[model samples]
Target: MAHKLRLTRKHQVALTETAHRNLKRFCDESGLSPDHALTFLFENASSVFHEETLPHRLRAFKAALAAQET
Candidate 1:
């Protein structure tokens, strides 16, 4: 028999409208519920981290910092 893990805690996060829209679109297209999409992403977190999928704002901040040195 396969064991199923129960997620007993709820985690809430705030996102910009654009981010939320994109996430919703992705979930809709992939046929995954929001919770399941999050679970799937969590399970493959290492790959996402390795790919450096930082949000656009954060990437822009990094670029700004680098430009200051030039």
Candidate 2:
């Protein structure tokens, strides 16, 4: 059985208008609600931290930048 988690804390973040618009556009393009997108991102980051070695993470960052440039 899975343990239940409670929502006990919320944090507010401020985004520039351009960033806010971009987030909305990306969510629309991906067919994701903002909350779902955020949850997915958080879960993926947790998995990466759990399984990645320092060198692997560094290499991953380099790969991400290289992909962005193309």
Candidate 3:
């Protein structure tokens, strides 16, 4: 159910090691390649904002990145 896009747009993003690992895990669980997974998630990202734990999870992830920068 992933990777149905034509892929006309290309965006490059940098991820921390933790994020890279998390993405790999998510793609493995969902049976998606990284490109397809990114496409699917970008398209569906709006839905994530409605999750009950979204704020907490976002803060936790950001805090890790912030800590690394300091």
Candidate 4:
């Protein structure tokens, strides 16, 4: 049986311009509203982390943001 998803929590996030653009593109291509896409991603995030280079990519992403803040 497929598990039903419920959006039971909310948090605000600041997205980089590139991230925002990519998210918009993904939403358009997938025909999912941003809310549904985000909810689905959150529910399935473990799969996302399975990409071998994701940890490296995450560090680079964080470093870039830190550089912007400095």
Candidate 5:
């Protein structure tokens, strides 16, 4: 049987109005709750960092730029 994963940690972040609006827009477009979206991003980052061929640092920078464009 597969167990559902749960995140119990809490974090507080400060965002500018524009950043918050962008995050909200991304959440709306992807149909994900803010918590889930953050979880997904962290999971994706983990995978990216584990890759061998591409430098993890470069990939992370690219991902950040892509996220900003959304």
Candidate 6:
């Protein structure tokens, strides 16, 4: 089971080719599909944004994955 919330946004930017590829690789490495991985991230974003813990690790993980695509 999962909780759902309304997430309002001011603007939406479609994913770039590089970003899509990077996210796909990250998802694959993490054993998740792109959609599932995104859902997972948003669900836990509160912990990530408010808490001063683990965001650096998450950023590093994303950076490493992004680096692979470049």
TM-score of each: 0.59, 0.43, 0.64, 0.73, 0.55, 0.44
Backbone atom clashes (below 3 Å) for every candidate: 0, 0, 0, 0, 0, 0
Q: Kindly report which residue stretches of model 5 are placed more than 4 angstroms away from their true locations once superposed.
A: 46-70
Model 2, range 1-70, lDDT digits (tens) per residue?
9966544456676887986897788799889876665655676875645464867878998998799999
Candidate that would win on TM-score: 4
Assess candidate 3 and give its TM-score to the true structure.
0.64
Candidate 4, RMSD to the unseen true structure: 2.1
Show pairs that collide, candidate 3: none
Off by over 4 Å in 1: 49-70
lDDT of 4 by residue, 1-70 (tens): 9977677787787897998998899899989888888887777898855678888998998999899999
Decoy 2 TM-score against native: 0.43
Predictions in order: lDDT: 0.79, 0.72, 0.87, 0.84, 0.81, 0.74
Q: Please, what are the lDDT tens digits per residue for candidate 3 over residues 1-70? A: 6955587887898997988999899999999999889988888988845778888988998999899999
After superposition on all CA atoms, what RMSD does each candidate show versus the true structure?
5.3, 7.7, 3.7, 2.1, 7.5, 7.6
Which number leads on lDDT? 3
The candidate with the higher TM-score, 2 or 4, is 4
lDDT of 3: 0.87
**lDDT value for model 1:** 0.79
lDDT by residue (tens digit), candidate 6, 15-70? 97998898889798999866666766777877645576577877998999899999
Where does candidate 5 have its weakest 10-residue lDDT segment? 45-54
- Per-residue lDDT tens digits for candidate 5, residues 11-33, read 89788799789779979999998
